[model samples]
Target chain A: AQTVTQSQPEMSVQEAETVTLSCTYDTSESDYYLFWYKQPPSRQMILVIRQEAYKQQNATENRFSVNFQKAAKSFSLKISDSQLGDAAMYFCASGANSKLTFGKGITLSVRP
Target chain B: NAGVTQTPKFRILKIGQSMTLQCTQDMNHNYMYWYRQDPGMGLKLIYYSVGAGITDKGEVPNGYNVSRSTTEDFPLRLELAAPSQTSVYFCASSQWTSGGPAYNEQFFGPGTRLTVL
Candidate 1:
């Protein structure tokens, strides 16, 4: 079974600071995809970033980036220069075989 | 484009009641998916469809059903509501590729919050 784990339930970061949300996944499939999604208080699920397992280079989308260590099975999301709008629930997911498995998610609080 | 949209932003159901969650996409995406997010938890896949008339079970399909009768619509049915079924339901759609599903980035709807008593 494919499983994604986000150990931290909650995280807080001061505005303009950087915060890294930890996520680890286990999958037998060699070729898969990893994603980080952000859900704001409005209950909308927004895609933050994505990384392909075959790619050695990490993925970055503006202020959001991923440190994807395939060998270690770790896919952590880093929010640089975090702003108040960055506050939300973050989810880590693994996609393989036409299915996606998501972690428990971490609630991010941006302190102004 | 509307991308993906789900009807009934919020609904409440009593035990043993039934309801259908409607989902639609305007992007002409061939892949549609239903997922439920429990409190303090990430989203769990309930069902998915690669195309019209073809649906498959996902990670958590129990007590839930889905049908894909057209390319634009995928409605999820709950035959009997239970408290355990209370969660925020999300509908997602993605463009299909011959290569595989890994390359597709799913677009999600605003989500429907369902509460079963």
Candidate 2:
């Protein structure tokens, strides 16, 4: 069974600061994908960033990026220059063989 | 595009009851999925459909059922609702991009909050 783990239950970062949320997964498949999703108070699952297992270059989407180390099975998300709107529950999900598995999620609190 | 839409935004059911959660997507995505988000837990896949008339069980599908009669609509049915079934249900859809990782990129719905007493 494939599993994604986000060790941190909650994290706080002051505005304009950078925060990195850690994620690790165990999968036996070679062809896979990783993703970060943000769920706000509205309960909407918004895609923040994505990474392909075959891509050596980390994926970056504006202020959100991911350090995906395929061999180590570590996929961490880095949010830079965070804003007030960045406060939300962040989820790490890994997908392969038509199945997507998610970590427990980390709650991010952006302090002003 | 409306993306993925789930109906019955909030519902409360008694034990042994049954209900159907409606999900529809306007993006015409071929792959649709059902997931349950428990309190302080990761989203668990309940079921998924690749296209019309084709559906498969996911990680957690023991107490639930789903059907895809068309590409746009996939409905999830919960039978003999138990307290453990209470959770936020999300519907997601994605288009399969050949030779690409787009197949794993799923767009989620607003989610349905279900409570069982």
Candidate 3:
């Protein structure tokens, strides 16, 4: 069984600041993938970033990046230069054997 | 590319009623999935298909049924809609090439909101 955990229920960040959302996962598979997805008010799920377990280098997409510590089973997302549009629900997921287990998610609010 | 699309942006069903949620992908992905998101919760997979005519149950597959007749379509059916079934459903697709750059990164649909009374 695979399980992802996001401990914080909500987080607030000021404009132009940076925020890091923590996520931890447990999986038996040696080879797998990690992902961060964003769901806005429009109910659209968008992919934020992804990391492959085989790769030692972390994944970064523009202002979004992930700190993936494979040995510790921790994958946290960092959002740099946060804007008001960053406010949404972020979910972390672990994928293996064609299935993904997601965390409960954390709500992010941006202050201007 | 239309990516992934789901029909019926919003729907309301009475208890005991049945409905099918339609999903389609034009990216020619080999893997497709169905997931439901409840209030203040993460998305849970209900079903998935690796290719045409190959369907499998996911984490939460009790009340939902799914079929993948073609490479482009995967439909989920609810036999008996209940209050617990009220949630937003998402359809996603991904390519599964071993050691591919975009492997396992799923592309999602806009999601369909369903409420059962």
Candidate 4:
């Protein structure tokens, strides 16, 4: 079975600063996909970014990027210039075949 | 387009009661899924359907049932609700190609909060 883990239960960052959220997964399959999803208080699950295991270059969308180390089975999300809107629960998810597995998640709070 | 929608945004159920959570997607996506979300625990897949008439159990399938009769609707049923089953339920849809890409990207709907006493 595939499993995802986010060690941090909660994280706080000052506005305009940078914050990194860590994630790790256990999967026997060589090919898969990694993702970071954000959920605000509205209970909406929004996709933040995604990384393919086959790609060596990290994926970046605006200020959100990932540091994926396949050998170490680590995938971390980096948010730059964090804003108040960035305060939410961030989840790391892994998908292979038709199943998507999610971590426990980290609650992020931004301070102005 | 209304990508995905779930009815009854919030529901409170009594123990041993039964209810069906309705989910509909207008995207005509080939893949649909039901997941339960708990605070600090992220989300757990309850069931998934690759397409109409092809449903399968996921990690936490116990106490839940699902059916995909059409391409657009995948309703989840709880036969006898328990306190443990009280959580937010989300309906998600996506398209899949044989090789990659689409297989990983999923569109999620606003979740339905269910409380079982």
Prediction-by-prediction clash tally: 0, 0, 0, 0
Candidate 3 residue lDDT tens string, A51-89: 988999999999999999988999999999999999999
lDDT string for model 4 (B6-106, tens) is 99899999999999999999997999999999756889999999999999999899999999999999999999999999899999999886676524588
CAPRI-style docking class of model 2 based on DockQ = medium
lDDT of 1 by residue, B1-117 (tens): 988989999999999999999999999998899999999998898999999999999878999989898999999999989999999999999886766555588889999999998
State the lDDT at B62 in candidate 4: 98
> Model 1: runs farther than 4 Å from truth?
none
TM-score per candidate: 0.96, 0.96, 0.95, 0.97
Best by TM-score: 4
Task: Point out the worst 10-residue segment of candidate 2 chain A by lDDT.
Answer: A93-102
lDDT of each: 0.93, 0.92, 0.93, 0.93
Query: DockQ values for all predictions?
Result: 0.74, 0.63, 0.59, 0.66
Off by over 4 Å in 4: B99-102
Candidate 3 per-residue C-alpha lDDT over B1-117 given as tens digits, one digit per residue, 9 for 90 to 100: 999999999999999999999999999999999999999999999999999999999888999999888999999999989999999999999989756543467889999999999
Clashing pairs in 1: none
Arrange candidates by DockQ, descending.
1, 4, 2, 3
lDDT of 4 by residue, A1-112 (tens): 7899999999999999999999999997778899999999998999999998999999999999999999999999999999999999999999988578999999999999
For candidate 3, the TM-score is 0.95
Tell how far residue A98 is off in model 4, in angstroms: 2.7
Q: Cα lDDT for residue B98, model 4?
A: 65
